[model samples]
Target chain A: MESLLERYRNLVVLLAILVAQIVGLAVQVRRTSAGVNTLDSSDASGVRLIRLWANTVVSPPERLIHSGFGLFAGAWTNYIDLRHVRAQNRDLKQTVDRLRLEEAALLEDARQGQRLEALLGFQEKYIYTTVAAQVYGTSGSDRSHVFYIDKGARDGLKPDMAVITPDGIVGKVRDVFSHTAQVLAVNDTSSGAGVILESTRIRGILRGDVSGRLEVVGILADERIHPGEKVLTAGGDLIFPRGLPVGVVEKVVRDPDRDAFIDVMVRPAAHLERLDEVLVITSTEPRFSPQQQQDLSVSAAEEESVPAAVKDQMKASEIMAEKLPGLIDPNLAPDQQPLHDSSNPNPVVQPPQPLHPDRFSPGSAPDDVPEPDAGSPPDAQPRKPSALPSANGGSTLPGSNSTPEATPQRNL
Target chain B: MALLGADLRRDLEIHRYPLLVYTLVPLTALVLQAWLPRVVGRYDWFDLPLVITIYFALGRRSPIQGTLMGAAMGLFEDALSHNAIGINGIAKTVVGFLAASVGIRIDVENTTVRILLTLGLSLFSSALYLFVNRFLLDLATEWSWLTELLRAVGNALIAVVLFPLLDRLQSRD
Candidate 1:
C-alpha cells in the first residue's frame, strides 16, 4: 500500500488540487444560482471575501499609477501644449455663442413641455447627482467585461448605480469595495437594460451578445427598425434614468434562433473600449430642474386661480401667455390687455410674475414672435401683442394659424 | 530497462531560479495582465500569466513543483479577474502538470520546441477555461476558433521574446 501511494504521488496530488478547485467552483456556482446574481445585485451579500481581499490588494497600485499618469499628462498638456490654445479658444467661443442661441430655443421648448407635464401630473426621474470616477484597470479577461473605477463605497458608491459618460451610457456598478468598484460594461453578456428606439418608440431589452456587441432583443420582426435610430434608456430597470442616450441601432437582422424576434445591433454611444473617466449616477431621484420647478409653481398658481372649464377652453396661445407674461405687448395699457374674467370662456389670466423674464428682451416682443419679412405683404406686419383675443372669443398668436383641435398635445 | 532509465534521466535537465525570480515573475505577470488592458484597451490577445506558467513549468521539469506553481499562479490570476477562483486554477494546474511531464521526455532547450509547447499549452488552457466556464459552471462564453488560434499564435510570439529573457534569470550554480 505504501509503495503504491508513493508511486502514484504526482497523480494523487494533481487529483487533489483539481478536486479542491472543482469544489470551490461548485460552491460559487451554487451561491450564484441561489439568488446571488452578482451582475445585478446591489449589495455586498453576493460578493466573496476573497474578491474583496483581491480588490484591496490590486486597486491601490492601479490608483497610484492612474494618478501618476493623470498628473504627468496634465502637466504636459497644461504647460507645453499651447500651440493650438488660441485657435481652440476662438473655436470654443464661437461654439459657445452658437450653443447659447440653441440653449435659449431649447429652454423655451423645455419650459413648454414642463408646463404640459405639470398639467398631466407626470413625474420624471432626473440624474440628481453623480460621482466622477477614473477608470484604472479592467478584469483582464475578455470573457468578463468589467473595469475598476477609482471611487467606491467610501465615496458613497453603491452597486447597480448607473455609470455614464458625456457621450452616452456606459454600464452599472456590479461590486463595490472600500475605495474601488467594478463596473460591468453595457456590452458584457450579463448586463442588460430597458431601451427604447428614439424614432419609432419601439421598446426592447438591451443585452450584450457573446462577442461583446450590444443587441436589442424582445422587439418583433414586423416592426420597422432602421439603422441610425437613436436608442434611449427606458428606465424600467430602475438602474438608469429614463431617456438617457444609450446607443444607435447599427443593424437589424432576423434572429437565427427565433424567427418571430429580430436582433437589433447597437453601436454604443460611449467608447466602451477606451474609457478613461466615467460619471457614476449616485442618485436617480425624481427631482425637477430649477426651471421646471418654477414652471410647475407658476402652473400650480395659475391652475388654482383658473377653473378647469376655463383651462380646458384656453388655447395654446393663451396658455403660452399665462406662462410667459413678458410676451404681453408693452404698448398696451393695463385695461387694453386681457383681464381675469371668470364669465369669459377665453379669458387670459396673467400670472403675478413672468415665469422666465430673461427669455424676452426688455420692452420688446418675445424672441419667438416672428419679425415681418421684408419680402412679405403689408398685412404681414408684426402684431402689437404676441397673443391677442380673436373676434371669435378664442385667443390667437401672431403667426400661428393652427386651430385649438389641431394643436398637438404631448403624450405621456 | 536499467540502460533505458539511465538515458531518460540523463535527457532530463532541471533548471532552477532565484526565489525572487520565481515569486516576482508571476506577480509581475499578473499585475501587468490586470493593468495593461486599461492602457492598451481590451488587449485579449496576450495572456502573460499563462505564458509565465508554461515557461516555469517547462523549465522546472518536476510534476509536483509544476502543478503547485500552476495552482498558485492560476488562483492568483483568478483572484485578479472576475472569474470564480478555481476555474483558472484547474485549467492551469492541468497544463502545468502536463508541461512538466512532457518536459522530462523532450529536449526543451530548442527554441522551436519551446514555442510549440507554449502554443499547445496556451490553447489547452483556453479550452479548459471555456469548458469549466460553459459546462462546469454554466457560464456564457464567446468561443471563436479563429480568435483562439490567433491568441495562441500571439502567446507563442510573446514566448519567443519572453523565454529568452526568463532564461537569463536561471541560477548558474
Candidate 2:
C-alpha cells in the first residue's frame, strides 16, 4: 500500500487539490442559489463578508495611491486647463442662455400638457428626491458588470433604487454596504427594466444577454419600430419612475426562435462605460405644478359657489313668480315657460349672457334686475318682452292683458 | 547567450527568500491588479496576479509549494472580484502544479520556454475558469476563442518582458 501510494503520489495530490476546490465551490454555489430569491442587498452576506474583507484590505492602499496620484494630476490639469477655461466658460454661458430660453418654452408646454392631463384624470409619478454619488470603481470582471459608488446605506441609499445621470438611466443600486454600494449596470445579464418605445408607445422588457448586449423582448414582430427611436422607463417594475430616458433602438429584427416576438437591440443613452457620477433616486411621489395647483383651487371655489348661485337665482325666480303673474305666459306649458327670464320683463334691458351651471359666478347672472330687498334706479324698467315685434310682425307672447306700455313696472 | 543560459540555470538554484519579500511581492501585485485598471483604464485584460503566481510557481519548482501558492493567490483574487471564491483558486492550483512539474522536467532557463509556458498556462486557466463557472456554478460567461487567444498572446508578451525583470528578485544561491 505504501509503495502504491508513493508511485501515484503526484496524481493523488492533484486529485485531492481539485476535489477540495470543487467541494468549496459547491458550497458557495449552494449558498448563492439559496440566496438568489431574496433582495440582492440581503442575499449575499457570506460572499459580501469575503468581498468586504478583501475590499477593506485593498481599498486603504488603493485610496492612498489614488489620492496621491490624483493630487499631482489634478494640480497639473487644473493649471494647464485654466488657459482655455475662460473661453470655454464664455461658450458655455451662451449655451446656458439658449438652454434657458428652451427651458422656458418647455415649461409652458409642460403646463399646458398638465392642464390637459388634469382634465383627463392622469396622475404622473415624479422623481421627488435623489442622492448623488461618485462612482469609485467597477467589479473588475466582464460577467458581473457592476460599479461601486462612494455613497451607501449611510447616505440614504437602499438596494433597487434607480441610479441615473443627466444624460439617461445608468442602472439601479443592487447592494448597499456601510460606505460603498454596488450598482448593477443596465447591461448586466441579470438587470432588467420595463421600457417603452417613444414614437410607437409599444412597451417591452429590456434585458441584457450573456454577451453584455442589451435587447428588448416581448415586442411583437408586426409592430412598427424604427431605428434611433427613443426608449423610456415604463415604471411597471416600480424601481424606476415613468418616462426616464433608457436608450434608443439600434436595430429591430424579427426573432426567428420566438413566434410573435421581435428581438430589438438598444444603444443606451448614457455612456455606461464612462460613468463617473450618478444620482440614486431616494424617493418618488406625485408632483403638482403651480398651474395645476391654481387650477385645483379655482375648481374647488367653483364647486363651492355652484349651489349658492343656483339658490340665489331660484330665490329671484320665486319673487318674480309672486309679483308678475300676468308677465308669466299662462298659455304656454309649465316646462316650456321660462322661469328666471320672466323677472326681466323689460326686453330693452338686455338679459345678461346665460350662466353655465358648471362654471357659475355671482356676476354671470343679470344685474339689471334688482333684488326685491334692494331698491332699483328709476329708469331701469323698460319695454316688456311683449313689446318686441316677432319676425312675422306679431306679438310672440299674445293674448296677455299686460301690454308693453301698460305693464306695471316694478318699484325702482 | 551561452553565459545568459548558464546564468539562467544558476539562477534557478532554490534558495529561501526573506519573509518580507514572500509577503510584500504578492500583496503588491494584488494591489496593483485591483488599482491600475481604475487609473490607467482598460488594463483589466492584464492578469498580474496570474503572472505573479506563475512566476513564483516556476521559481519554486516544487509541485506541493507551487499548488499552495497558486491557491492562496487565487483566493485573494476571488475575494477582490465579485465572482465565486474557489473558481480562480481551482484553475490556478492546477496551472501552478502543472507548471512546477513542467519546470522540473524541462530546461526552464530558456526565454522561449518561459514565454510558451505562460501563454499555454494563461489559456488553460481561462478555459478552466469558464468551465467551472458554466457547468459547476451554472453561471453564464461570455466566451470567444478569438478573444481568449488574443489575451493569451498579450499575457505572453508581458511575460516575456516581466520574467526577466522578476528574475532579479530570485536568490543567487
Candidate 3:
C-alpha cells in the first residue's frame, strides 16, 4: 500500500486538494442558503470581511494610479482648452444673459405652480442631505453588477438610500462598509424600483435582466403604453421619491408567459456604464416648501371667510331660496335662525352657538348689529339658518306658514 | 521538430520560475484584473488571473505544485471579487491539475500549442465555474455559448502575445 501511494502521490495530492476545496465550497453554499441572504439584510459577513480586506489592500494603489492619470489629462485639456477662450467666453456671456431672462419668466410660473400644488396638498420632495463620493471602481465581473464608492458608513451612507447624479437616478446603496459602500446599479438583476410611465401614469416595477438591461413589469397589455415615454419613480418603494426621472421606455412587447402584462424595456437616463461621480443621499425630506407653506396658510385663512367668487355663488343660492314661499320661520326668534343653508329642503346645519335673548329683542336696531371686518372670519351669528322647507311644502318653525312674509320683513 | 513524439514521462523538460516572478506575476495579474475594467472599460472575458494560473501550472509540470498554485491564485482572485471564495478556487484547482498532467505528456512549449491550450483551459474553467455556481450554489447566471467562445478566443489572443514575454521570466531547471 505504501509503495502504491508513493508511485501515485502527485495524483493523490491533486485529488485531495480539489476535494477539500469542493467541500469548502459546499459549506459556503449551505451557509449562504441557510439563512444568510443579501436581500434579507444579513450580508454574507464572512465573505464581506474577506472582500473588505482585499479592497482595502488593493484600492490605495488603484486610486494613486487613477489620480496620476487624471492629473495628466487635466493638464492636457487645460492647455488645449485655452485656444478659443476669448471667443467662447463672449458667446457664453450672451447665452447666460438670454438664460437669465428666461429664468425670470420661469420663476414666476414656478411660484404659481407652487401655489396650486399647495392647494392640492402636494408635498415637494427635496434633497435634505447628501454626501458626494467618487466612484473608485466597479465589481470587475459582469455577473455582479455593483460598483464601489469611496464614501461609506463613516460618511453617513446607509443601505437603500438613493444614489443619483445630475442626469438621473443611478441606483441605491446596497452595502455599507467603514470607508467604502457598494452601489447596486439599477441595471443589476437583483435591484428593483417602483416606476411609472410619465405620460399615461401607468405604474410598474422596474427590474434588470441578467443581461444588464432594464425592464418594467406589471403594466397591462391593453394600457396605452408606447416607446419613448419617460419613466419616473412612483416612490411606493420609499427609497426613491416620486417623480424622479428614471429612464425612457425603449421597446414594448406582449409578455409571452402572462397575457395580461406587457414587457417594456427602458433605456436608463444615467449612463450606467461610464459612471464616475455620484451623490449618495444621506437623507431626504418630502415636505411643503416655504412658498407652499405660505400659500397653504393663506388658503386656510380664506376658508373661514370664503372666496369672493364662492360668496357670490352662495348669495345667488340664498336669493333663489327666498323666492320659494313658506320657507322662513316667523315665530322663531331672529337669533334662533339656522346659521347655514336653511333655504335648501335638507339643510346641513352646523352646530349652533347659544344666543342671548337680548340680541333678538325687538328693541335692538341696525346700529346695534355687529359688523365683521373684511379680513375677519364671518360671524357665527350672521344670517340665521334660512328657514328650511318642510316635506309638506311648509316651514318647520311654528307659525312659519301662517306669517312667512312677516318673518322676512323682520329679518331684513 | 519539437512537436515530434518524445517519451511523455522520461523526456519531459520541467522548468522552475524565480520566487519573485512567482509572487509578483500573480499579484500583478490580480491587481490588473481588478483595475483594468476601470481604465480600458469592461470586458468580462479578459481574465488575467486564469492566464497566469495556466502559465505557472504548465511550467512546473508537477500536478501537486500546479494544484496548490492554482488554489492560492484563485483564492486571492476570489478575495478581490464579489463572489464567494471557493468557487474560483475549485475551478482553478481542476484546471491546474489537468494542465500539469497534460503538460507532462505534450509539447506545450510551442507558441501555437500554448495558445490553444490556454483557450481550452479557460473555457473548461469557465464551464466548471458556471456548473458550480448554478448547480452547487444555485446562483443565477446568464450563459451564452457564443459569448463563451468569443471569450475563449479573446483569452487565446491574449495568451499568444503574453506567453512570449512571460517566457523570459521562467527560471532555468
lDDT of 3 by residue, A248-322 (tens): 999998888898889899999988897776777787753567888898899888776887889888788667545
Models ranked on DockQ: 1, 2, 3
DockQ-best of 1 and 2: 1
Q: Give the poorly placed runs of model 2, Cα more than 4 Å off.
A: A1-11, A30-46, A72-412, B1-12
Write down the lDDT of every candidate, Cα atoms only.
0.79, 0.76, 0.76
What is the C-alpha lDDT profile of model 1 across A13-62, one tens digit per residue? 99999999988777665436564423222223433676667667667766
Candidate 3 colliding pairs: A337-A385, A338-A384, A338-A385, A339-A385
Q: Write the per-residue lDDT of candidate 2 for residues B40-136, one digit (tens) a residue.
A: 6754566777887787777776777778878877878988876677789888888888887776666666788888888999999899889888777
lDDT score, residue A120, model 1? 32
- Tens-digit per-residue lDDT, B1-173, candidate 3: 14434355425577777889988788777777777788777566678888888887887778888888888778778777656777888888888888887887777878889888998998998899898888777766788877778778888888888888898887766
Write model 2 residue lDDT over A217-310, tens digit each, in one string. 8888844677888899999998988888988899998877887789889999888988776778888854568888788899998778789879
- RMSDs, each prediction? 40.9, 36.8, 36.1
Q: Kindly list the per-residue Cα lDDT of model 1 for residues B65-85, writing each as its tens digit.
A: 889989887887777767678
